[model samples]
Target: MIVTSFFSLFISQTVFAKNMYRWIDDKGRIHYSETVLPKDINYRRESLNKAASVKEVVEEAKTKEEQEMEKRLVRLRRDQEKIITRQKVYDNALLNTYHSKADLMMAIKSKMDAFETQNQVVEGNLIRLKQELEAQQKNAAEMDRNAQKVPKKLLDGIKSTQKQIQELHIAINEQKEKQSQIKREDEADIARFLFLTQSLTEKRKGTSIPSIKEANELGLFYCENDRQCNKAWEIARTFVEYYSTTPPDVYNDKLIMNRPPATDTDISLSLSKIPLTDDESQLFLDVHCRESSLGKDLCVSQKVKDIRATFIPYVNDALSRTAQ
Candidate 1:
């Protein structure tokens, strides 16, 4: 009887040899059998040898929703990669272009001075053209008073002077706009440079401060997750309202802003919430002044700098208190 039982066990093992299969059910239970049931055919399964080593694996079929989610994840990853690439390029340019913030400021001043000179020249021409137009008008009026018809040449001269004056006005406005654009671009560059250099310095020294001056200079606040970011957004909105001279213009989940500055003394503030990942976000604050010399000076003023510098700390303290 013992010999017969041993033979039967050996036969059973041989029969199950390469035909053994392992699979997981919908409830996540592991199952092993010599034959796969039709109901478990679509589930992920593995073929096993007599030694219980996996011989082959068959993947489970994905649902449409799962496939779509995978596609979205791929696209999101690609977009994130592109953003990282662009940021690297910007950082390299900032580091290579100027050695110091003062140097960058000087370059901006030089360019702005050139624009100012051009505008001055346009103003001079405009004044001369106005005088010429007045003279031509006087001649035409004198001719009319004497009951003489105004000469076609004189009329044409007045029209030409007026046109030149108009052109000069347009040119002056364009130059002012260009100067404003330059200031905005240059200030942004300076802020970026400060941030990069500060980071590099901290890395080299193997130390980090709780508050980064560069972050303050750039008017940026960072949050590690969505909950903190949402709370920070409200704080940023209040900060903008307290500082902005312009009235509110837009308010939304991703952006909060005030109208553009209407006067030289007016300051408009805007905040944008940028997502770095599902959990991480950045709040960026921007200050806008009028497109004039006074307005430009205001942007770089100590008062404005203080407002920016305090933003992150304000949010940090508020969030900490709430947690407590």
Candidate 2:
């Protein structure tokens, strides 16, 4: 059964090519077998292809099965080579971008500080805009409640103020999103910068990078090999699943979201403009109920332009917080 299973695997691997062995026997007869015989002598192995290398070889020497996989293996090597080349370029860029990793961290922090400051300013503007818009809306409502024809002057005032309010609201909303995006990117850069600098630091002292493949994957934020990163990604997935896909079992038309702590006051107006399904409405409400770093980031990231952005930022944030 074992031999049969072995042959089954072998055939699965080598069905594209057949091994040819040639030998001149004592009777002056040439004999060939697919499988190499024990204690075989005077047998010559055939070359399957011209483009064969040690990388293309399997188990010490190239075999017919190896030849069958040659083209496929070559394509895979090309793909891997591209990944390696891209990573090497990034390594060089990291080394050149700053005098040291500390310098990079300083720059990243400065950029993040700028984002936070900008968000604060936008928040203040939003507060003023909301107040102004409310006053204008109140005046218009009182005029209507008195059963008076809405005067052209008051109508114009309300329209102008409403337009300005919408513009400011969208501006602040967009800026908050940028803030979250920058934070996400900063975390990833910090992780990659530390990995690159540490590896290079050790290389200067004669030890090579721990494992080029591993460093490359980490540097790229390929979270498959990282448990914390994977968990963070799972958290992000749940947010996306709940918010973007899985709808609340029952849609609550009366359950209007009056903005969570993030204070998206314009969202009500904005939400009214867009045609949202019951599922999407439930999603918006459900998102307001959840509280997590990943959930907070999603609050900013989701927009009409990108209802389905990957949660890599959340993953990066999680990875950066994980210890050595």
Candidate 3:
């Protein structure tokens, strides 16, 4: 009975428990193992039974610094997604709100007219309330000067009239402020609406952004002929991240295609925003080498020189800290 129970338990664990140890090696490649990890390596435990993609599982394993970097990346991706979702919602709302700039202008004018008419009513009431309160105060002053107690009803009337006048003033100011805000918002909305609509029309007519894969292919075109293909793959992964996130305007004028109709010119890239940090940037930039008949590969771009200049010092600085 004991042997049969033990066998059943073993079978259940083998079938149901798909525990995995995920880790990144010194070379930054992600690895997954079912039973044993490398003799000296630390791994993060993961359950493969869960619906996690291989990419997500790999991302789950990282060093402390890598984890912080990933956190920042996740936050940025979330913020970008929100911006895209908000843009879609605004685009829909814009379409439903008005048919043309003229239509929007007319709508704004009508709202302005309504506000002006309401404010005129409020102003007239405020004038009347002020007059009544002033008259009541004068009456109370006259009674006090003659050494007589102010009439209770008259004092009450004065207080109530003053309150009404204050309330009207507040209402008028609030209404005017809201109208100004609405006009400003409408102006911005119309501009954005026109831009978004125009872009959408152009996209429908076939002018569209390049796909991330296409951008990666473009970067790989120059590096794909490397002897082992290691450098090319690394460059492709880095380019994929860069192309997907960086604004096209930053490099639209300076796109370097390695195997184009032009000769090899070392390109220097400076972006308004760099998605990779110092170390992460070095990891990809360090892979640039071309096979030459003279036995050793010479550097092509001054950009690569800059990378080496900064990366070596950065690594040394980090190593010094560990030594301390």
Q: Every model's Cα RMSD, please?
A: 18.3, 22.7, 17.5
Candidate 3 residue lDDT tens string, 189-285: 8777666665564478564322334423222122112332333333333343342322222222123223211213322223221112222121222
In order, what lDDT does every prediction score?
Answer: 0.84, 0.52, 0.54
Q: Model 1, which residues run further than 4 Å from truth?
A: 1-16, 19-69, 209-324
RMSD of 2: 22.7
Write model 1 residue lDDT over 288-313, tens digit each, in one string: 98999999999999978888888888
Q: Write the per-residue lDDT of candidate 2 for residues 1-324, one digit (tens) a residue.
A: 796678646644553344444344556554435455665543344323322211222233457887879978999999999999998897788778877767988898888788778878877877887787788778879989999777898788878877887888888788778878978877777778777775565577564443534432222222223444334444444444443432323222232233333333222100111112222111111234235565455556545223223233444565567643
> lDDT score of model 1?
0.84
Q: For model 2, name the residue pairs that clash.
A: none
For residue 227, what is the lDDT in candidate 3? Answer: 33
- What's the CA RMSD of model 1 in angstroms? 18.3
If the candidates were sorted by their TM-score against the true structure, best first, what order would they fall in?
1, 3, 2
Highest-scoring model, TM-score: 1
